[model samples]
Target: MVTQDGATVTARSIDATRDWLERNLHSTSIIETERFGFFYGREQALREVSLGIPIDGVTAIMGPSGCGKSTLLRAFNRMNELYPNTRAEGTIRFLGQDLLKADPVAVRRHIGMVFQRPNPFPKSIFDNIAYGPRVHGIRHRAHLAELVEESLRRAALWDEVKDHLKKSALSLSGGQQQRLGIARALAVRPTVLLMDEPCSALDPKATDRIETTTRELAQELTVVIVTHNLQQAGRISDHVAVLLAGGVLAEFGSTRTVFASPFSEQVADYLSGRFG
Candidate 1:
């Protein structure tokens, strides 16, 4: 067969192309996982998953329900341990450190997480943003204030909540609350941010704002987001990893390449809404 570029295509050629792309795309990755596996008791949620998240761009992990998209994202920061009987295998390296063996608290400090739903503390907006900093030992009021402002600004929420800093965070709209959650995560000054379907519960307008914030955040830190929305992934991700239902990574590459010409039939079918 021949591609639209008029180049002859064969199974061998396709494999070679994909292999080359994978090998070269993540040469300077900030996080690399090799033969990684995760188990919740006896059931494996992730199986031999391998991928590299670049240091300066948004990487979207996409898959159908129960495909371990969130499982892999949480593994980066050791969040999986929150569940009983959960364990990880193989290696996950973050900045050359063995992430699976690293101190969970320190790993979390460097890699912040934003969950599927906005979960702000039942405190004032300012307090919500200041909580992480306080946990990290920033007790000076002035310094905490500065960090709060900076974090909110980074989340694109400072302008809206600037005058309402004393108000309860729960009073904010769903979108605002989500942005507040992002701001709270940023207060710790993490090098990487992991978002698990952050916009899945928001409306289109809210999703757009989060996407904009994500793009801006990518300028300063590595971002790995788990999203089921294919369009959202295409819009915000520089790289995309598609996981199959059985905890397998079916295809991973630049967003353009994966969406336009997936190497795996499973990825193609999933992207085309055939099975997913």
Candidate 2:
């Protein structure tokens, strides 16, 4: 089960997926969608969209405001399930498991998410990072502490907040708080991270820090980011998927190719700043 462009499929067994990854381990895809569609009430938010997200790299989703970029991103982790009358059609495979059929909690555990705004819980930094592990039944204080530290380190916020683990998360700067949000997501040890306009709410410096952190995190995890900023998408992503009205995927390819030569006029127009 592989796409023509060499993107791996997600419907096979885990063993098959593992074998595929091992064989093409350096060329493995972490997630795959085939004819995926989504609906909000009677309105179709996405329609027959398909794409692949490679492992240990960034896949940026770019499109106009109503093109369903975020909708598709949310579907990857079943976040769409939270909304009533929202239905997803077709298959989404993550590490070879059907995301729509899999347990939502389990799907979320393996695919953590970060929102546009920094959403730290109203708790100390220590507790914030420890929340995921605690929910999964990890109660050992030492283990929790180690996980917190490791997650923070991966998120590149350890040095700044390590000394203040017990401090209120709200006390941190906007950039720091965003990193805390990322650290909280990483504490669960997710293999895929979904980011939705993560820098929209931050200042330039904070955005830079988050971008740096995202680059580092890609060394170990699959990253899918939805961003309005075409420049940011070109700068950070290895692959790019451009969406259009009715949630259609207009074009997808290597970052350089997509940005330099889009396949559709819509994509070209949006990228060229002609109109959304």
By lDDT, who's the top model here? 1
lDDT of 1 by residue, 155-209 (tens): 9999999998999999999999999999999887777899999998999999999
Candidate 1 lDDT for residue 103: 78
- TM-score between candidate 2 and the true structure: 0.91
Write down the RMSD of all candidates, one decimal each.
11.4, 5.9
lDDT of 2 at 61: 95
* Model 2 lowest lDDT segment of ten: 2-11
What is the TM-score of candidate 1?
0.90
C-alpha TM-scores of all predictions? 0.90, 0.91
Q: Global CA lDDT of candidate 2, please?
A: 0.85
Off by over 4 Å in 2: 1-27
